[model samples]
Target: MTRRASATISTQPSVTDAPLRYRLIHDQLKNAIALGKIAPGLVLLEGPVARVFGTSRVPVRKAFEMLHAGGLLHTFEGRGYVVASPDGSAPPPLRAPLSESALGFDEAHAPLALPSNSERIYHAMEAAVSIGITFGHFRIDESEAAEAFGVSRGTVREALSRLRDLGLVEKSAYSHWLCGPLTARAVAHDYELRVLLEPAALRASMPHLSKEKLTLALAEVERAIDEPDSIDADALERIETALHVECLSQAPNKKLLGMIGHAHMPLTVNHAFYNAFNLHPEAGTLVEHRAVLKHLLAGSTEAAVTALADHLHAGQKRTLQRLKVLAVLPEPDLPVFMHRIS
Candidate 1:
């Protein structure tokens, strides 16, 4: 039988963090092992851990290297690393799931320190490339991207590697990085997967959704309804995180989360739709979000699940409509990193 990781995957940030994906994975594994969910002497495999993070094995391997360096794991000459048992008398602090940590914030207090510069650059590139791709297909130019972002060639490459993992970008026959014009088939496939996965996650999430968190998430919806003019990629992520990822954070299964993240193409596709059409998120979206929250607040898990499903259905409809609008748009004004291919 395959061993599943404990629900507490411990993706929390460490103090004095040097920003890198591998380092974050390393910390999470360390925390998990210390908490005893991952038993001592259990062989840690890279493939499973990489899937949990929705990333590639390259980072996971690097994380293992660091874990071994820190004496958290022991390596045999032939076999892979083993989780070194901690001192019996003292165990490390157990970390809570993300929903527990994120439940009580309002607009008054700012969110945690934003990701590092390279991290921020990664998201920026994704948004620009997504919007540009929606307008029309484009081949990416590594040098041009570096110059446009004012970052080094290495930084752009790192960002591009992440994009490739997300299935949002691809390499072409001519050895160029090609970004979308996301196809209708791709959109349909994503919806099918979400319909299967998200409701199950929402059902599993009810016990974890605190009133404080529900209220906070509800308030954000209301605010967005009142001020939906600036629904950029980051803003969209905030809304989705509050509704989707946060609610699902408590679910015992980490692989479900990974599958959802890997196939969650609509987030970018819908953002691109809005940008290409030059419109704000629909008012109906706010109402839909409210309905889901109201159901959750009233302690109706099934109803909440239904409302969430309806919201997804509505989003699918709007995405189709927006696709029609995007169909006629010209090649968008894009950063130099993108070269028109079609």
Candidate 2:
């Protein structure tokens, strides 16, 4: 039996100026413990709490650490935390099935609003910029993008800021946003960093990778391989994400995860190439994916990590070739914001 969270607290941001996400989670769990909605000896795990909040486990783990520091939660000889007994005495762990309403978000307080305007438009902007860069040097008009997306310039600016963080776009000396002419050197540079960083991230993530999750990821790869004709650029991207982003998402080091994300500029190139050519990922690409996923499912963490690095190594050549092809082809129709500069 597994104990579950049972809480009643507002998800709304507090009056304080601090970031709301982690603070909200902390407050919710603290209130639950104080109210005895969560029993004194019940176990609370990061995974379940994260699922309830529809967020990543990192913040949930942070909240748990905060609770332990505050003496609201204490460590037992187990994986998760135990709620502190009110009388300053240790109690046996309480394990039982939780009620339907237990650990549920209150309907009135549910945080179900759509993401901010910037987030909503970010992927589309990223895709457009990624594809645009393959053609030649270009300038992005902030005002034009605002009009095209029916958003404010400020919103567009924020989205572009994120793009800059990922090294997708940069400001020229004249202060215009420019995306390029992705060079082979840049592709190789990204892979060089990935081969070092991604394998380490995968090793850190192995402890958290559940068998079921790996199985589903492997199944997706196999499906793409079997039905290559049915696999489009979008499907190819999905399989790539299953291994790269989603699989590695559970790593606890925030800075490491951010670095891994920043190093993925090459992913956009691969995606844009497949879409441009109306092609699927190469068979070798799918086979490499299958190999890594299979090793993970077999509990060979080192082998899986090594396989991932090998895949990246192979992918660099493929991506570089695609870039060469795109460089030679006539520029396709671009979005309103983009203007070819060279």
Per-model clash counts, in order, read 0, 0
Q: Quick one: best TM-score, which candidate?
A: 2
Residue 250 in model 1: lDDT: 81
Clashes of 2: 0
Error of 1 at 241 (Å): 2.3
Query: lDDT for model 2, on a 0 to 1 scale?
Result: 0.78
lDDT of 1 by residue, 199-284 (tens): 89989978888899999989888887887765543575677778877888788788897787777777776654443334556678
Q: List the candidates' TM-scores in order.
A: 0.61, 0.65
Question: Which residue pairs show collisions in model 1?
Answer: none
- Name the runs in model 1 displaced over 4 angstroms: 1-115, 172-176, 226-237, 272-278
Cα TM-score of candidate 2: 0.65
In the predicted model 2, the residue pairs found to clash are none
Candidate 2 local lDDT, 62-93, one digit each (tens) = 88889889888888888787888887555777
Quantify all predictions' global Cα lDDT against the true fold: 0.70, 0.78
Q: After superposition, how far is residue 73 of candidate 2 from its true place, in Å?
A: 56
